[model samples]
Target: MKEIRVFNNVPVLEDWMIDKQVEKQIRFLKAVHPQLTDIHWNEGRVELRPLKRDPDMKDYLRSYGAWHFNEKDVAELKKFLQQINGKGVDLYYSAFAFDYSMVVYKKDGTKYEKGKVNGENALFTSVLAADFDGITVEEFRREKQRLLDLDIETIDIFTGHGWQSIILLNHRVTDKEILKKFTELMTAKGFKVDSAIVDAARVLRMPYSFNCKALDKKTKYYDPVSPKIFATTDHSWTERRYHVAEVFERLNSLPDVIKQSDALTDIDVKAISTAPLTNTEKKAVKEKAKREIEEVKQIKVETLKAVYSMLDFERLPEAVQKMLAGSQEGLRNKVMMFLIPFLRNTLGLSIQTIKQIMMLWGERCSSKLDTDFVQTEVDRIYGLGFKGKHGHYTEELRKAYGYLEFDKYTKRNKIIIPNGFFEDMSTMSDGAVRIFLAMKLGESLDGVKNFSKADIQKYAQVSERTMERNIKDLLSKGHVCKRRGNRRKGEGHVYYTNPYFNSVAGFTMLENATVKLMLSDLTDGEIKLYCFLSKIVGDSRAECWTSQKYLANKIGKKGHDSISKMTGSLHEKGFITKKTIEKDGVKHSVYNLNY
Candidate 1:
């Protein structure tokens, strides 16, 4: 068995060496206990008793021969150490009360329960000893390497009989729960942790102190195994100490221990039962949350409604309109299947209301929709909710459904047309009327306004063939003039409308409110009738005399009854009044304008 030498009695230190060691010890103590004012040294036993910096501290220091040491005491301490050499006395120092607490093992090597210190908010430095009965030197070396791998800065000390690893923590870890969890983790990671050494009252052997346990009477030094500078925080201080802030940070980052079996571990059932919410209060909170959701939903719905309303459905191609109307049940189902969610989510329309509208639209289609199939699809869609897949009508669908035209319903950068334009074009086809408006509305009223044939076709939703025909008719009737541009340069035909229509005998200037009502609320047929009546009656005349058949021919209606129904609708809307009149034994309906 290897015998351990516990004291360095063979070499007597020179006066300078003894003074240097004493100064170092004092510096260490001062760093750890900066507030201590009373330090007592008696027969190789040092005690650092702290006193309040008051008159009482001065009196106590004088009486007990305790004083804060300075450079003057260094020589005296060196002399004292030389006198005590080989006197069977061992050098010892009182452990200064640090800003931290640590555990120390008793000399008997007995294990005890881990104890707490008073300053829970105090900072700490930890040390692990591999001096147990069976730990080998190789095992200690391996443990040191392991701590290095964990990024823990360690100060290795050869403590005469064994090894000690010191780690300094930078921050305060005041919570006991945190400390317990940290220790548990360290133990799990194969560390030889001294759990009982966590007490604040524990003292540690000072570095460079002489151990008196050697049977050979030779003094063994409690020296640092590693360079002192390497052991300090950031390797910046020249002391046998280290900052293990990184290790503490890693420990803190570990996931909190979760108790799996106890579901009610966190619940304070007694407190909850004592302060339960009233039924009315709970209901109010639920309602408030629901209202907030509904308000957000409403804003989204309004935005979608605006986009849908901007589409000119009436101007779509005939085939596309037929598809939308469900002329083919298969095609209609495919289209409506995609559009239903948009109607529900964007317009906030009820499923029942959407079904009703689809059913009505189907009647106008070439083939009516299947009610059973429609009902089933709507129910299925409502169950799926909105996932953004079918929440919008694509551009392809818009073109196929005859919504590609730019009309009053379409959003525009700007639209400027004379009030008389509509009245003058009342007798034309809807396509022609829209084309004429498109020509005039491109810019502000100016001299010789120009419009390309392609632009007119796009805005009016008319075919090239139809556009040519409309331009020809307008030119022949003296409604507009056309100028051809160079075809090689991709220039198009330029057309200009007459400042005023010659055929319109008089003009009726309508108010902004009236024009808005006509554009947004009135049907095409109603608008045509109102424009015709306004022209014939002029602002001067209140009434006009004409038969339903003649009125039907003027407004392009095929049936006299259709004209009578339009008249009645206009009358009900307060736009016109109707009465019978006779001239030259011929009876006629006289219509009078209300505005």
Candidate 2:
């Protein structure tokens, strides 16, 4: 006889074999039945069952039930097997213990009864198996080779007396009808598929474990064989197993194994345990959406009042305009904080209206504010009290919105350019007007003041080229004089405001610090409007009673609305406040200085 490798009628599983072979089977088992709560194995037999809750494992095991397998139970299992190696114990494991149940119905609409079966239902998955009884080892090997030739990947396990080969699917198959059809197809292919094993409670020999056979009163233990040679093996198999994507690709390649129609049809709601929403639920959802849309539209319409109140909103500097329009959440929130009070106190709008409008505005932001955050902000504003008479506009609010800050210039150094100087400069480029103002507000106490090109460029918010062009225009127009600095040392040119200009008025009687701080954040149009208001208010009084038409004429703007809007922008920036004063049965706005 060819040398048969047997160890004293006992099969010894080496540590390396357990690591390589037995561990792989355990992994595949876990992958197949990941929801398996409990598994049972005995010294001479193996049984796997899902843990029942009430009785518990300790009670069931005491009643001669198999040992339960948990995450940590694998080590205990290996140790038990090692101790019972020569004691005539054989290991078997339950297969197909999935969460889903497959039921077979009889003609009476009741579950079909079977003999010696725990239940008519079975746990079905992607696993497909075929039994080859009364077949020699050589014949079984040839059958496996034939399946390989046909490009069908499978795992073969020797059951001591017979063989059982299984087809590992790309994914788990849970549909009962599909499982039934698959089994029928396998039977048609001349493979011995056990129809009785379709039930939930079924067991198969645990691969890599001993298979004890008793013949003529003599016992012999045979080692189960499980070799890694399959294209569609479970990824939990070896160290370098197939990935889910590869498994899907392999599954797609097998048209006969899984028909496209069957695969697509099986993806219905019944397959995923989800039901379609009822018509009543859908109608409720639609109504909610419609209500939300109407609310947003109403809020947007109301907010237009606050937007229109910023009369010189369009006349604000490009940077200020961008800060208002751009999606900077913090800056936008700060703007809202100042605007809410302005609308309530200055414009006299109600809190409820402001809340709705601000909520919608927050929603329109680039990074939309959450409803809770918007609500919190509205609550904060409410807590501050109405204070409709007292103003909430502050330097902090202006600075928070990226308003430029001006260096404090002393009152003695104030240069009072005539109202006509602004009128004449307004006709030039905005940059030119800004540069002239920058030169006028320098550190010098009188007449000629020294200002670097960098200082003028920064104050004017212009590029180097634009600053140069504006400076040239100012010099050509006799508004200022420029003395070039040392070019080699990278020094800037010095600029001096022309004191002898015909339109030049005496030094401004108002506080220089107030004028500089107010002018720092205003546009050319705003500056012109502020100058007209200053002339009207005079140096002694803080308020000026005037009509929009009068301000419009002074600013050279034809539209009274334009004048009102410019005044609003001035009001918004804390330059001036406008209150309606009725005289001779006619309402006129009295502009007051808030500086």
Candidate 3:
């Protein structure tokens, strides 16, 4: 039934060959949809020759077709598979199921109406898959070992060029967000994962099918001898479905390479700072100096720097920076287009300051700009008023910075915090503020079932006593309400942020203000300042005029100096733009929210 060839004294199979591939495909299908029955066609569909990409056309999936199968149609499925074997087109199957009755396809083998699988039409997914491509065998081995170390069991599919690690969940997951988070956590675990596949409608290479792309002689991936087929060397199929929490807990348990990069030295905390660690005891009197310095350093930069990488504006392209310093013969326009506006809008420099800087930049150029021309350019740019998409100079500077992959803020998913919440936050203690924010964020994400007091402390980055004390404070203040559960039932207090503060409804604060406040590296003091500013600024205004004395009083700070320092810190960190304006013989600071 199959042809064989001899080349260079080696016998090669002309067709894709694998052991028990048909049986394996059946088992995978059954595992994915456990309710498969002979009475009706199964939920999933088989895709034939799906378009990878097209230079001309968009919505390529709509141009493709699929084969629907019944439980008793294994022989027919086999016949179809045989017909397409080595036909130089990929065979794919939706990893998740769709509503069979609603499925539709055109007579010309193209998808019609509701035939394509997507988050809306697709029903549920039983497996979470991560695709890794173009990696070396040794690298793959290392990734496998990393998973082994984490005790994460996956059905590892060797798909021609790379591996696809699939985690078969114990139950079908309807929440796409949870599935999305799984891939994100995998990325944090140092796995080079293709995050695009974490969706309800994703497809994988059929187990019995050949990787037709690899057979193309024109492509760099073409291999003549290797059989580019879906096969697994280890039979590590998970026997039991893993609870979503259990899987998440395992993935989030260990610190990945980035987190562990700065291994804590054996240096005593007492040696770093004399101020006792809130929970731990003092080790030695001599450790006090070291402890204080370390604490100050940690508070100022070290820990927060690692978390909020967006502050590193230096990560902007070296070419862009070099252009600002000195443009070569052909690229003077780039400095005018990109660098000038970057300094004006992003850096928030005054026009005069920008002029002075540009003059210096011109001097450094190979062929220096004429003084009057430089002056005219600066005047024209300033006249345009730092607006993006300004008439002549486009927002190419902003675009250049965007390409740097700055630490992205999480999408709000329409969760809006009321402005009153920020005002209330200004009145609370730092520990209480963190705990309350954590609970609010937790509720927004998963709800009350998952976050306990211990979990709250971990998320809030506060101590046990801090959590207990502040949680009580929150309850007494009516900012948070808690319901206690029976200890005998292994239940704990479930706390909820006040609905007034945490509303998914139609209220709004500064855009992504809550998420940014929760996730940024802003200190408690800085957060207090930010909350106060955000409250004043509200949703409508971009900039607010307020005095430091007023801000200090609102934030419960005794001195305006603290407010000034916080404002300066916030401005330096790109959270806000602070400028002094003298209005009616009195000086006031204009704070513009940037997050």
Candidate 4:
């Protein structure tokens, strides 16, 4: 079985625990959310963060034939088309488990052995269907009626009210891309579709749960088979669909979608959990797993001796001698301590300091393996010097120390070792979030006019896949506002951006970009009007009281002089405020928009 699980996911940066101070805001969010359970009265308003969500799993079931059929009603009816729609759900996590898989169908056409069900039959699922345009109740109601009047046997429509938009997935078709093309073809016939969900054109079955049953008409009994994963599946006996239109058309009762799968799963199974690893423990594990790789064959000892002929410090380069004299660390440090001992006697130095140097160099080991490499280096050090224990050092030491230690052992090397590093994500599948740390750093809206999902990903280092989840997170948590555009580009669709983070003063200058700049559909007239208004406010020394007619003439509208009405509309929008003032003994309304 192809394992597939649908989850309602969200991003981390947008998370916030609501507090008492945000009580009013919580009510506003609840007013818009249809699936909110209840406000945590004692916990304060922070519960709103997870409270705002986009529908995913709830929408999936709405589109499945096995869901919302109400077998109680099915027995009374011959066939039906069920219209299932879901309201937005509270999502603490963007990835909330929706279903499980219980069966596996091998490529070779044999049923998977139930003995290995835990290992071979089960698969963890991650669901991604049609985005916000999935399915709808109003549309399904119309569709079911249409199908019932026809010869259709079965049908399913799933719609999710996620982040205020509907996401629909229809399994009646075998291909999603093809469904999109077909929808477009229908659009040519006066309809536009968001998308289709057929990434894999096959039937899916829910696993573990015995809530579903396929009636075996020939056997005259309910033939129940429960799978582990949640999906649509073809019949075991034939390649045909059960045909749902006949039923929904035959029996016209629509029902509301069921709720959170996470809540049910949490009650029945272990949640997403993993053990963390300590830094030291992790480093040790890495070392133990390391395997040696050789780059070349070793040179014979006789061939090396013939090439060198003699070993003397005077024969080596000046750079080598300088490097050998000053270093301690790495392979070069071990060699230096080896050679310096021989030189100590010849140069008349104390034997005690030389021994101390050798012992000090040995302590530079980062791991037990490094110690072994150091030992080999120490032997090389002995060979490079004169034919005695008191040997000279090599140039390699200076180079190694040059990179490893710069400030003459005078300044203590400050190495910041993390107390621990996380490794639990390996099993969970996210590595420090789905994106990089640098990418997800919160942005200050001081210089931003408008931000896009791509912009969020580039700056926040979040995965593109997670951008949609992040948007709901940012908006629902009140990190941003879901602003509706009245300007030219797009009117009905909502735009989101940080409210508190975005500066109200000179906002256009700060981000150096705005909705007008990013989306091409924004009209030039709206942009011009904004720019003109901004210039007047920016240059004013004090409040200016000017007539609408004068302002209109200044704006170059000679046709009908719409100055008064235009200014009045701006005032009503809260963009500017009107106040009465006497100018040259004449009473006129002056607009104040500083707030």
Which candidate number has the best lDDT? 3
Candidate 2, residue 213: the lDDT equals: 43
The candidate, 1 or 2, that scores higher on TM-score is 2
Top TM-score model? 3
Off by over 4 Å in 1: 1-12, 27-69, 72-84, 87-134, 171-185, 194-196, 215-246, 251-595
Rate residue 366 of model 2 by lDDT.
48
What are the C-alpha RMSDs, in order, of all predicted structures?
A: 33.7, 28.9, 30.2, 34.3
lDDT of 3 by residue, 380-485 (tens): 6666565752223324433322233312322232244565555555467766766656665555554454466787876677778878877776787787777886
- lDDT for every model? 0.45, 0.48, 0.54, 0.30
- Candidate 2 deviation (Cα RMSD): 28.9
Encode model 2's per-residue lDDT on 1-595: one tens digit a residue.
0111223344455776555554665665653433332344311112332222211123322101122356566765555444544334444455443222234666689764321123334334435556665576456655654454343545555555566666653333444444344444454444455554454345555655544443112423222342111111221121111222233333334445423334423234224321233353345346534432221111232343345332223332332333334233224445555556654453333344346556656665544544544555556665586675323434544443344321222124344665545455434555566666666655432333577777777656667897887677678777788788879998767787775755435333333444455456787677667766666655544568777876776556767898788888877776676778778998888777654
Which digits, one per residue and each the tens of the lDDT, describe model 1 over residues 1-595?
1223333332456767667667765655443332222344311122332222111122222101112465555555555556543332233223222222234344588533222223222233223222212256556655654654343434444444445554542222223233343444555555665454443333444444443334222324222232111111111111222223345445334343533232212132112111122353355346534432121111233432333242233332333334444322113434565556644443334454456545555554433433543454567666667755243444434444444332222112223334455444535664455455445444422223677777667545567898887666567656678778879997877877776643444334432223334545556567667766665655354457767887777767788899888888887775677776777998777787654
Q: Give per-residue CA lDDT, model 4, range 1-595, as digits (tens).
A: 1122332222111112122212322222222221121322111011111121232233432121111123342331111111111222222211111112345677798765332212232221122222224234345333432332232212121221211111111112222233232223323322223444232231222211111112222322223342121122111110112211222222222221322222212222122221232343345335423311111123233433232221222322333333333332124334444445443333222222233333343343221122332334334443344545343333444334222222221111111111111111112212122221112222322233445556556644456676556455335434345555566765543433433432323322201112212122222232233334444553231355655555544445443235555556555543356677787998887665422
Q: Each model's TM-score?
A: 0.27, 0.29, 0.35, 0.15
Clashes of each: 11, 4, 10, 60
Question: In model 4, what lDDT does residue 314 have?
Answer: 35
Evaluated at residue 146, the lDDT of candidate 4 is 34
C-alpha lDDT of residue 195 in model 1:
52
Q: Candidate 4 lDDT (Cα, whole model)?
A: 0.30
Give the Å error, residue 110, model 2.
96
